[model samples]
Target: MVARERIITTVRPLDENRIRGSFINCSKGEARRLTLPRLTEIDWSEVDFLGWRDPKAAHNAYLVTPRGGEVIGVALRAAEKHRSAVKQSMCAFCGTIHAATDVTLFAARRAGAAGRLGNTVGTYACADLACGLYLRGKRRPAVHNPVDRAPLEQRIERTLDNLARFLDEVTTDNAR
Candidate 1:
């Protein structure tokens, strides 16, 4: 049997220009206005994607990741209401089981015509958008329950695969 390729779950450092240029759903002006995270302070080796909630606009969030050697960014809108702390929810990307309060529903407008038509896709993700850290053990979730008992490399691959599917949904022009 052919061996499956291992996925590298790290992103190269990104500058402001590159990050702004990577956005697909938002207009140039919107992208320009979007606040960026402090690039220099981030340890790129620890992250599979760069994600942050917009400081200037609390409900807005952004995710930038490398797909097939190309960097792509998505603008996400976080739901105003958060899940209750009493419940438990899992991150769709990293598979971490978090206190329900830690998971947020984020919607991304599809690229191109669909987005212009007001079409959006949503997913349940970590409120902080720090899936990479949780997956790599850099950060721990509030709850200690583990969902997937796979090896670290395999978990990384699963996370990236989940992200790829989400990206495809957002970038594909189903409106055509």
Candidate 2:
């Protein structure tokens, strides 16, 4: 049985429309066509952000994160599946160390024309994109974290900043 993890902070759950509307790079028709994972199937209390990969659309992943009382939706493309064993792993977002199989790499299409021209930026992230859960200790790291453990608030701030930087990269203005 999966251990039930508890969230330390209060976070409001989001709906499908809010999730679909937050995409910075995709067309409305594209967003509308994708299926949302069953919200009732998720453990909302343990998730800091909502995330899922569509079973029917393996290349597609979705993230709905609440930032400053507003939910932001990100449409993502997954790297082709590569499974292997490694000695150490650190999530590029939360920086938590885990088993190599627990993290996966993803590339986000840049917004607007840049995406049409095929520009994308990638990051190695928690397989489930549950950095917030790892930060709040709802998910535990499998390996010793190499970075010095700072105050919870400070770590949370850094993690959030990491996410913002990634978002900037996915936006059209930062496209390369």
Per-residue lDDT for 53-75 in model 1, tens only?
A: 99889999999987767788999
Error of 2 at 171 (Å): 1.1
Q: Could you give candidate 2's per-residue lDDT for residues 127-158 as a string of tens digits?
A: 77777778777777776666546987777667
TM-score attained by model 1: 0.91
Q: CA shift at 107, candidate 2, in angstroms?
A: 0.4
Lowest lDDT 10-residue stretch of candidate 1 = 1-10
- Candidate 1's displacement at residue 114, Å, is 0.5
lDDT score at residue 23, model 2, on the 0-100 scale = 75
Per TM-score, the best of the predicted structures is: 1
Steric collisions counted per model: 0, 0
* Whole-model alpha-carbon lDDT for candidate 1: 0.87
